[model samples]
Target chain A: MPILQFVERDGILDLGWGHPRPGLLPVRQWQDATRAALDAYDWQALTYGHSAGPQPLVDWLAEHLGTVDALTASPGEFFVTAGASHALTLCATVLAAPGDVALVDVPTYHFALRILRDRGLRLVPVPRDDAGIDVEALGALVDRLRGDGQRIGLLYLVATFGNPTGLSVGEPRRTELVRFARAAGVTIVEDDTYRELGYEGAPPASLWSVDPGGPVVRAGSFSKTVAPGLRLGFVQAGPDVLDRLAGIGYVDSGGGLNHSVALAMATFARSGAYAEHVARVRAAYRSQRDALVDGLRAGVPGLDVPRPAGGWFLWLRLPEGMTAESLMVVAERNGVSFAGGAQFHTDPARGHDHIRLSFSLLSPAGLTDAADRLAAAIRSVAG
Target chain B: MPILQFVERDGILDLGWGHPRPGLLPVRQWQDATRAALDAYDWQALTYGHSAGPQPLVDWLAEHLGTVDALTASPGEFFVTAGASHALTLCATVLAAPGDVALVDVPTYHFALRILRDRGLRLVPVPRDDAGIDVEALGALVDRLRGDGQRIGLLYLVATFGNPTGLSVGEPRRTELVRFARAAGVTIVEDDTYRELGYEGAPPASLWSVDPGGPVVRAGSFSKTVAPGLRLGFVQAGPDVLDRLAGIGYVDSGGGLNHSVALAMATFARSGAYAEHVARVRAAYRSQRDALVDGLRAGVPGLDVPRPAGGWFLWLRLPEGMTAESLMVVAERNGVSFAGGAQFHTDPARGHDHIRLSFSLLSPAGLTDAADRLAAAIRSVAG
Candidate 1:
């Protein structure tokens, strides 16, 4: 197997991982950007960088984030991280302590659950609807947990086009999310990683956008829009948060993590290549998503599949009396694989009947085939 | 202003930062390497990579490191990191807890001191002589600290070509250090970052090499030998240490940090470009070291300076009654700025009369000029 991805297997179709499709990886664009970045900065960009980030990229990120959030954003509010995952790890390192409670959306990005657990954090799941997190339920959980003597350190939210559920908190709910953080004495880490890929226009204003300096730290990533291998992202945060991040051992010692790559990103962003690239990727993923959703609905009888507004995943609430585990075993027999819902939940007892399918890593035709295979598996499991 | 470095001032010379010289940043080599990497891997390198690292680079590093350490090494024992500083941070996160006692070399890399301190590790300076750390004394101190109910976490050692003071722990002492760690039940993080940059024939066998799969974790970096901005390095350790690192939140979530950069590094190393690059840098630094030392000895009467075997710095022992603080004041007036020794000590009271000057960031002529300026400062300060 290749280090970055699994090689082609005999018959299995992998719709399991959230990794971007291999076909869409832009080699030419990166080559051009690398060439241009070196030409522009020369060797000056190769030394120990400013801890915040490359200035060109930092300033550009500020402006780019402003457009994405539909608000005025400044350079001071951004801290460059390796990725959303890195941002999460860093914040967990500096802001939260071991055994602190991290409230996450049920059926959240499953990998995030493991990441937080490895940090020694206790994960608690909050209820979610199609429009995203239920603020009232989250508030109640916080109250209940605090009353039980558990310290709720943060609520990790994928507010704009979240991972598995492909859900967004409505504008009012975003405001509530921030307000709840303040009232409950918690931080709301809004992962705006997929904000740019919203096919149904923009999903909603960011939690950070709703309250700029409030207890919300928004994570932005080029992984979805650009390339995951770049391993570059930024956190849109308040000054206090940035200071805490900057003062951590890693950032303080090494400056920014990927300085050379950021320089390329700076030139890429400055020259308008990033925007164009995101648009191209967005259009491609939209088609792939539609193809899969349409096939799932038509091919699978009585399957209640919600059409995601944006992002890569489609959440299939399993057919009556059918479980994700049984479907997964049958799916494997039928040459299709998917992430089962139990993987995403903090509480294992929940999410027995849900399946998350990624629409980003295969062609529309490939996904249509995957949909057919999945339909067969579901039918066999239901029988 | 550039985010990665300081722009040239009108008249000042900076021997302060240990950043690689801008002139030798090897922009073309990186550009070539990037192109080759993309072509070789296609889109395979553009996704979430192996948590250990890219396999090609990992394997190549294992072989290359064997050559450097003068012992056999294997791929399974290597864990790629962002850089040396990152290795320190990661180990600190896993191997120790806040308030754990960290035994450090006195007058070590000042930035590392800050990095460890920020991680909330309590640093206790272990006295050093020219031959490197006194294992007998360190054992006694460890016994004393444990006797006092302090949990001694790890000893941070730059075993070869250590920063601020270009020193290496001798071969027999390296063995003794590992035994000490075993007896004391502690980890020894040997920062082998500058090992490959030896201007001399070679430094001693690595601490890890002396006792592979023992209590040592050796950190290697492309920063000194290639480009710091690449933020690429690795750790050679036993299975237990690699597992601890790979299981960390950041690595688990993000796969590996700087995957794209590592891909480029893989091609660079495999093609023999890395060996060529290291040789060139070593030769350049050797001349720069000689030029500065000779200039200082001739220009400044009775100034005691030790010729560094390898790496970037020269430790200048101040003349009788002349302190580093007083010399720094005069040096600044003469348009030379070098790092003061007090910054490197864990305790504030030590290192009052020693100075550390980097020979990496300037040309031979520039370093010679800097030496002359420092000599003038020394005379003025002595008077």
Candidate 2:
């Protein structure tokens, strides 16, 4: 029994952690902003801000997000959360009540599932393929659950590059999913956390962006694009839903937001350096994805490595004999770490053979080393 | 319809808002800390911190609270939350199952009620007198509810300076509450948001502090003492519960607490400024509380104003023939604002006669003005 046992086994290059890459953090600028804020704005800054988060950041995100006419925001329509996860938790709090079920993508972001579960939501997993969460399958799941006398409160989806599986919901499927949710009276919580990391052609319009007038809640964050550490993120919900979240948030933080973070984020977004910074981040992760996939193919044949279109993770399926648990032990022995797949699944029995490797946290060199170490560990364990 | 409607009709003396009183905020020192952290520690400072919140802040709180025994805190027992409300929301998420009930004190902190209700838990309100949440009544409610086959999963209370009521749970009742919770096998979420504002006898040892062995999940904050706008708070739970909360916390700001805040709080605590600052705040509130009560007696002869033992509020009962709604209108017209009782209650029918006023947010002069205005309004409406 170790004193620091909660950290579990360390030095496993935690691809499991979802923080913004440290290198991408605008440390100097943020420090400057914070210092200035503390000096001049500390009095008001130390009190609660508006529950919707800092107004300048909201104004910046609205201007920068480029959502279609289908999506417009007034100040009150935006709610600030602790992070993207906090946003989802708030959404879960307001949208899903007890005994209500939230429709989720199978093999979805684990945090979303955890949030829903924590809120006492009966999670109905909508099956997904490589093309992203199946729109038709979603319709079927909603109907099946409804038929079973269950009320589907919301359909949780990641419209841009999703976590665990880095696949975006295609445009046609997005439209179909919205249509299905509207007809089923299921609200959509479209998590766009990884939207900025897209390596493909212009990303699909957000579900909220496409729905002319439907039940859709779009959540985005500075965690991925700017810095997750700043703990600044926003959700644009329909007025009714946003109002509910705002009421809850008012109780939560009394609108006390970190103005310096908001200011830094606003500055980061305006720095003309944002596009370049994002490109640098994506290129680094894109390269790591290519490296990790290539490493599996070349060094550890038989592991099924899915080449992600965008985002930091590469979801791997070990060869027939190996399990994520065994691989985790071997990887730790070799000083490389990845989230054991079993931990991510809502249904653990179905997720044992898979593991998620994040490429974004590691530098290209570190990622290459991690890949080689993980490859060897997997091979030794499997053999 | 107005794009945004506020609950502040009587207008908030605009007080009741908690955290460091605005005038007392250490703007200059915070500016220095912010600049130092940003310029020197920018790279690491801007990314996501541990999901539980910043490590240093957690460490500081663990030491400062000095309430819980050190034996209880292994590596995982302490965690940082976005705020106390964030901690409570996570507590509700982790502890309450949908269709499950959470027992709360009647005339409890309004926001706690909202947070519990938002999670779809039927708030089983147990009545309270000066000694804090009535333990005998709570036991009866549990027995009655249990007989009804309803499961109560959590017992939520504010031990020190109970919000709204401004009472502390004495040691005997504290022990009894713990005994009652253990008998019911329900976890207790003790919210000590105003512990530092103690103006009278020594602060009662927290139930969590004394009965470190029991299942009490404690939440504390820098907001009330240092600055609420900083949005800095922590939750101490059993390791299993804390881990679950940490996992869920990632979705929110990735538990990216304001490190600058953590540093400032740590600085404030270490510098011994906290106790001195709180002393001044206590004296101010005690004076204002006395003034408000005095004025109500002299000016509004028929009103019932309970002198709060601690914290910044005076819970007032409207005179016969006076409605909170109408009195609020008159109060606002006379240039004073107060939080109406309806916003804090789950049942509108029960709380309409109540109005909550905060003297903390105003100056002694402002308090006089507010009391005068409120007194005039009461006479105008009731006479």
Q: Looking at model 1, how many pairs of residues clash?
A: 1
Tens digits of per-residue lDDT for model 1 on B1-383?
35874456678898887778788778998889899999999887788788888889988988887677779788888888899888888877778877898889877888778777766789998866667788888888888999999998788988888887897877677788788888778888888888877877967888888778888888888898898888998888888888888887667767877888999999988888888888888899999999889989988867677888988888878998888888777888899998888888888987888888999999999999998998888888878
Docking class of 1: medium
Prediction 1 global C-alpha lDDT:
0.83
lDDT of 2 by residue, B1-383 (tens): 11111234444465445434468665665565555545544555565455555555556566666542223354356776657886787788778776789887767788788778766688877777767777788778888999999988788888877776676787688888877777767799999787776666567777786556367998877667766666777787777787676565344425445544555455555556666766766777778777777877778775667776777777788886667788877887787767777766656677788778776766776677778878898888876
Highest DockQ among the candidates is held by which one?
1
Q: How many residue pairs clash in each candidate?
A: 1, 24
What lDDT score goes with residue B165 in model 1? 86
Q: In model 1, where do residues sit more than 4 Å from their true spots?
A: A5-8, A127-130, A140-151, A183-185, B7-10
Weakest lDDT window of 10 consecutive positions for candidate 1 chain B: B1-10
The fraction of correct interface contacts reproduced by each prediction comes to 0.72, 0.46
RMSD, every candidate, angstroms: 2.1, 4.4
Q: Let me know the DockQ for model 2.
A: 0.36
Worst 10 residues of 2 chain B by lDDT: B1-10
> What is the clash tally of candidate 2?
24
